[model samples]
Target chain A: MVNRLIEPTSGRILIDGRDISKDDPIALRRRIGYVIQQTGLFPHQRIGENVAVVTRLLGWSRKRQRERTDELLTLVGLDPARYRDRYPSQLSGGERQRVGVARALAADPPVMLMDEPFGAVDPIVRERLQNEFLRLQEQLAKTILFVTHDIDEAIKMGDLVAVMQQGGELAQFGPPDEILARPATDFVARFVGADRGLKRLSLSRVGDLELQTAVTAHPGDDAEEARRRTLADPFRYLLLTDDDHRPIGWVDQDDIPRSGVLTEALAIPMSPLVSRRTTLKDALSMMLAADVVAGIVVDRTGRVLGLVTVESIAAAMRPPDRGVGAATDGSGPDAARRLAAELAARDDQELGRTEATRA
Target chain B: MEAFIGVFAWFADPANWQGPNGIPTRLLEHVVMSGVAIGIALLVAFPVGLYIGHTGRGAFLAVSLANIGRAVPSYAVLVIVFPLSIAVNRETGLFDIAFVGTLLAMILLAIPPIVTNTFAGMRGVDPDLVEAGRGMGMRGGQILSRIELPVALPVILAGMRTAAVQVVATATLGAVIGGGGLGRYIVQGIARFDYQRLVAGALMVALLAIATELFFSWLQRRAVSPGLSGRSVRAYENVAQLGRVDVPAV
Candidate 1:
């Protein structure tokens, strides 16, 4: 019933512009992997055997099976040496889902259909798996159709959001931000939530944009001077740091002393120091919890890199309200079409450079 | 009552331990009859039961065949097999009527439980376990041998135990048909109204049956892991105590 429901009735379902439905279903199924919601796995079989079953059934030789199973284990971020001999009953839910994905990709499928694969795991593990999948998707470039009742998950993972209605009709279809900003109908609007604008920030990452500067102070700086700097600047806090320029803490304007050294005594420990590589979604959560307007973005060495303010987060979150026209162009549809062409040309140029490098 | 006690005391007396009327020979005959019958039943029923279980399609036919064997009373089997054995060995004139007829009757009595238990055990395996095997690309034969057989072993053993005890008890029927056994002593006692030998024969058969049952049950427990058997017992108990129950098609 599930296969029939997703089956293309009139025309072929294309992947990478190739009509694969007319081809052999065995071949098609091999190239299009699927992950069910419950991470359906054989509890009695060892994890490696579970992943290798499809490959063996497909008549891959022993050497090839070994190679492919190991490759898939690494691909799903599970060390084959550790997990190969264990059974599904012995694994955590997240690990089971990872194995599920590995098994689906057993034949090196170019397309993956995931049906709420992370639903069984706790939130922290789910988030890690989601991010890991995103990184994998970026490298593999597989055309993925991920299903979830979770609108947040849909927004976070989907490149092109396709909201399905109660009876499984396409309710809305567009980019994540566009669908969130202007839902096609009441159903979509309610589904994305009334605060859909805020939810969009979860899809944006800190690495996607440039950061703004903030007031900085050395640990040996006079407390009076740090207070004077905070009063003069628009930002309320001064970022305190060590002599080596690593961010130590921050001194709020109200907490600074008159004529003493600005040591750890005057500074509050930095609770929301997000790395520059952190997702805006994660940064926003930290900022919200800290009740601070901005987060200090640090490097690997904890150096005070820059700050992510509320305005940058808001700007990253908000979509241009004027539908498709405002999306590509600053002006109108003709200009927007030109902008799309230019972006495509730029992508083509980058591809050409990569090929040249390969040559 | 006084005469019964005197007879009992006479039997209990050490002087009559190996006395006349072939008392020692009768006890030996009883042990040999039961041991031979059980041995033959085990050899025949176990393999046949396993075969019927693996096939799984002809449950009604298999069950009917087994039930027919059981429905034929021990006396009937003895009466039927006696003449047949004599006719086959007529030229040799060496037919051991008592031993051979008792063996046939015991085999008939033992088969029903073995066949029924085997079928029930094989059928009782959770379908999900079989599906998991198929999904792992296991062939039907491999699934049956590696997964199904090992899991159903205890239940199969339980059935065999029941059949064994039943057969050992029923071997006494051999005595009435000129079949030499402790049953010969039982028949002699009844003819002369000498209750002492009759009570002794009856007690020996009861002890043997009880001992066989205990040994087989211990074997069954040892065949499967303790944890798995305990879980199965607990699960069955919970279902039984549910009060409003939907009976399954067993």
Candidate 2:
């Protein structure tokens, strides 16, 4: 209805106070960006033209379109120079999804409608694309009306999540944490799932959690001293970092010899490395998947920031228990309050959100 | 089988190459008439096909028309038009009935594949792509010309290929109605009981048809976009079935 793909039988959908029903659909659609699950890239068009489609339609100069295409592709993390002339078929599913996003962003529309945009890719790629999109969103801040059936996706993507029932009625509208913490109806509750509290873990990023310091030892450090330090910390596993402060692996305290200098071989194995921006839910999943109790928090350069342990994540999941000293940063209680305030602020904004892509 | 041996001998003769009734003149006539007929068919069929395909209206009528066209043989159309062209030629002295009749028959033969294929090509484009185009604020015209047209090109050209091949092969019937074309050699050879001429003429016609087939196939290859290259074989397999020409080789 927003782009007049379908007209509402009743009610007006206003994007910026202008009723979408009354506006010229062609002009209105041009002002809004659109993406679909399949990416819907014209198979005949080159990537550059695909990205610059709206610009070409709006009659931008050839040079200007080229510049915009490069900029948008770069913004979406695709190297424009290499991908510009390539066809959509030549790209991987994930790459094509990126192109789809870049194409939508090409015209720099204030509003974007993403209908399961990353739905086609595998779980790993979807996560990567979602993270990249979120990072891009932080920069661009387009008024995006993202549509998805996956509740996890809905909770992760939407700043003001709208839970639409089967009949297209807005069941619950609030921040993701609110919807997770408090379902307005029985339908919404079941829809959010029995593990809605665990789902709330997705709402808070690793950055929100106060990381626990892991005992570190350089490869050439005295094993006696390293074992002493590792044994002293609550987490007995020693975090091995190279000279440049990049994390290598974990050295079990039992594996450390008492007298010799520590070598790279002393470390048993590496845990899944996570960035500060990773959701606590993903970090927890990574820790479980690695069969370890902790995940190594790394910076952009892969330098060790600290470790986010299972206990710390659990501490962040609920109100900070005063008994757990690891959550001293108090992310759990603070995250809840911050999420509540964010939901309250979002309630004030009147946006008749999204059109579901059910069929 | 015995006469087939004389084909080489027929081509070797200098006499066959030099006269007004020579190979070059006949070849030129065949080329010129086929070109004109296909050109006229394109002008007539493309817009109709494009409108029906793009708008998605009158689809049943278009398909029925195409099927009806395919059912009526070009030879029958040529024979029917023969007397009508004669009447017009006698009255106006502006056209040769045989030539006009043959051209008309060729045009009629060419239109169906082009029309059906154009429609199929337009329809074959993923609706989501069209939706995407429309969502991006492209007007109906822009969607048709830019998005639908290019993605649909291989299929459309496939249709044209079917039409062109059919027209080129069927145009040989022109000589059956006192027309001028490479078909003239066939008609004249059979009339004179010159086995060499008959064989040679038939050979030339077959060669021309082969050349036409190769040209259009090359064209179809060129028209398909790089973006569609990965799955084009599969896509074309589906679309080709729609525009498939089952007309017997004349």
lDDT of 2 at A303: 90
Candidate 2, which segments miss by more than 4 Å at Cα? A205-359, B1-5, B231-250
Candidate DockQ values, in order, are: 0.07, 0.50
Summed over model 2, clashes come to 0
Quote the lDDT for A39 in model 2: 100
Docking outcome class, model 2: medium
Reference-based lDDT, residue A290, model 1: 93
Encode model 2's per-residue lDDT on A17-57: one tens digit a residue.
87888788888888899998899998777788899999988
Top candidate on TM-score is 2
* Cand. 2 TM to true fold: 0.76
Tens-place lDDT per residue, model 1, B1-250, is: 8767865775687754674445576666766777777677777776666676777777898789888987887788878887766665675667676666777778778878888888788787666555444433456686676556766777888888888887777778787777776676678779888777677667667877788889987776555532235453344346546743222111
Poorest lDDT segment (10 consecutive residues) of candidate 1 chain A = A350-359
| Tens digits of per-residue lDDT for model 2, B73-128 | 88888887788888888999998777888888889888988999899988888999
Off by over 4 Å in 1: A1-164, A168-185, A188-199, A215-243, A248-271, A321-359, B1-131, B134-250
